[model samples]
Target: MRKWGPLFAVSLAAFMLLIDITIVIVALPDMASDLGSSYTDLQWVMDAYALALAAVLLGAGALADRVGRKRVFIQGTVLFTAASALCAFAPNTATLVAARALQGLGGAAMFATTLALLGLAYEGRDRGIAFGVWGAVSGAAAAVGPVLGGVLTEHIGWEAIFFINLPIGLLAIAMAARLISESYGDREARIDVPGMVAFTAGAGLLTYGLIRAGGHGWGDGLAVGVLVGAAVALAAFVVVERRTAKPMLDLGLFRRASFVGIMAGGLFTQFAAFSGFPQVSVWLQSVLGYGPVKSGLVLLPMAATAFVVAGAGGPVMARIPPRYPIGGGIVCVGVGALLLTMVDAGSDWPVLVPGLVVIGVGIGLSMPPMSAAAYASVPPEKSGVAGGALNTFRQLGFALGIAVVGVVFRAAVENSIDGTPAAGRDAH
Candidate 1:
């Protein structure tokens, strides 16, 4: 137990943060009913956390490298625990969304430091064991998150999902303080505050604009203005990255074709596979009238398949050229998305099984190699930055994917339900 104490601490933090990514899907409807949330509020509820995570992830990494990984991790754990309490007690959708964003900031701090802390804590065979176990825990988080959330929401209420994190966060903090030692990377590494701010502004504005366009039309003056601001902010982000002395992401890496491909693969894998999940949960509960547990169970095949494939096939896939596995795997994801198009007003839950399984297979195949490929593309000194960049892109993809899918889904639903009996029903 002593030998693996660091693993326990880091894995606990990883599980808590990663599970939050999907745990809320099954509880969205319950939250809506309780909070009187609008459709846009529901979208923000999901996107706000993801957006904050994506935006802060790389900067957090840089900050950790300078300030000490263990110290930052503990601070993050404390903040995450406090934010979870805020989320549990939030009185409205706006407050909940704000709390969720705070949770994401804490999550970023923990996530950015976990691997580094593990690297510092272990060596040789023990390090390998620690990493393998941590990887399994990370994979399992997604698989179990919804089921756990469903059970908690059904039995204990939606707030239980957030409240559940409290004990886990506190335990992680205590374990980390007792067992984990401080470590640092480039002590001079600077947080790219301007770049983070610009990128976050751009992404947030873009999502807001899309949500606005869904209800108010693309030509709505406010939507158009926000979209234009998004463009300006994104452009400013690019400029800041190019000019900053120690950027969270080194923009020069994009000059490499392989690096670009790997980044794109990382981003779209999440977008193609998991982005529409919140909307799916909404359909299951509101349209199909499934309870939270049943709705969570409905999505289990994909995550289960993903876990099995990644564990079983990872070693074999590592032997081959990464491009084949990553490329073919993402293609599978796109095909699975196509398969999901079969879901209609009259379809049952099983319609999702085949698509989910395929996407799972894709995720299993692609994700294991993504980190290695990204690291290989850069020099040794830049490997950490590369890792941070890949994760940032992936989270950004999830955030943006949710916004885009929500807009399209709303439009399609409106078109299909026009003058129909379902049109009069509560879709929110």
Candidate 2:
């Protein structure tokens, strides 16, 4: 128990944070109804968490290195657990969004240190076993999130989804403190404050702009201004990265075409795979009148199949060239997403199954190799940064995907009802 206790703790953190990502999908409608949330507020409920995680992840990695991995991990777990409590008790959408963002910040800290802690705790074949178990836990989190959320939301209430994290988190913190030894990287490493700020601001502003534009249209002055601000902040991020001594993200990485491709693949893999689910959940509950449990069940095939494939085929995928699996897998995801577009107003949940399965297969095929490929793309010294950057892009992709899809979905709905009686009808 002592030997594997660190893996258990790290896996607990991964499960909590990753599960939180999709758990809310099944509970969104209930939350909106209780909190009087608008569609934009609903989007923020998801976006705020993802944006914060994406923005802070790299910085969190650096901070963990400078401080101690176990220390930061514990701090993050405490914050995340506290924030989960706040989320459960939030009185309104605004407060809930704030709490969720806090959760994201904490999640970033824990997430950025999980692998490092595991690396420090295990050796050789034991390390491989730890990683395998961790990977399984990560996938299980996704597979179980919606279903668990559904059961809790339906039987207990939406608050239970967030509330459930508290005990799990506390257990993790206890195990981590006692079992996980502290580890550090280069003591002289700088935190790259300027770059962190610029990247966070840029990502946050861009997400806000997208959500605003989705609600108010591109001509809205505030939306346009926010978008411009995002552009400026992102440009500043590039400049700061170039000038900073020991930058958070090394700009030289982009020079390698393989690295660039791997990063792009990571981004789109997440976007195409998971981002549309929130809206899909809303449709299941609000439009189709399906109960939360049924909705979660409908979504289970994709995650479950992905879990199975990744576990069973991991060895075969390891032997293949990274491109064949990653590229072909991404293509599968694209085709799967395309299949989903075939749905009409009369379509049932089954319409989603084929696409979901294909996407699952794609995810399973692509995910295992992505990290290994990312590490291989850069020099051994730079592999950590490369891994961090890939995760950043993946999270950013999810955040942006939700916003972008919301805008397009809203436009399509409005267009469909442009001259119909429904065009001017209000829900009240």
Give the candidate number with the greatest lDDT: 2
- Report the Cα lDDT for candidate 2: 0.78
lDDT of 2 by residue, 1-428 (tens): 99999988998989999999999988887887899987667778877888788877777876777777778899999999999999999999999999999999999888777766765676555655565566556655765788899999999999999999999999999999999887776668777889978987887787677667766767889989998999999999999999988887778878988889888998898888787887677666656667788888988888787777666665566566778878988998899888877777777788999998898888777765675576556543343455467777878777667667766687553343232332211221
Q: Least accurate stretch of 10 residues (summed lDDT) in model 1?
A: 419-428
lDDT of 1 by residue, 1-428 (tens): 87899989998998899889999988876897899986667767777788677767776766776677788889988999999999999999989999999999898888777766766676554554555456556655765778889999999999999999999999999999999987666776666778878876876677567556655666789989998998999899999988888776678878888899988988898788777887787677666667788888888888787777666665566567879878888898899888988999788788999998898778777775665576567554444455567777778677557656766787664433232433323232
User: What TM-score, to 2 decimals, does candidate 2 have?
Assistant: 0.89
Q: What's the C-alpha lDDT at position 424 in model 2? A: 19
Give the poorly placed runs of model 1, Cα more than 4 Å off: 1-7, 118-136, 189-191, 206-220, 375-384, 411-428
User: For each candidate, what TM-score against the reference?
Assistant: 0.86, 0.89
Per-candidate RMSD, Å: 3.8, 4.1
Model 2 ranges with Cα > 4 A deviation: 2-4, 119-133, 375-384, 411-428
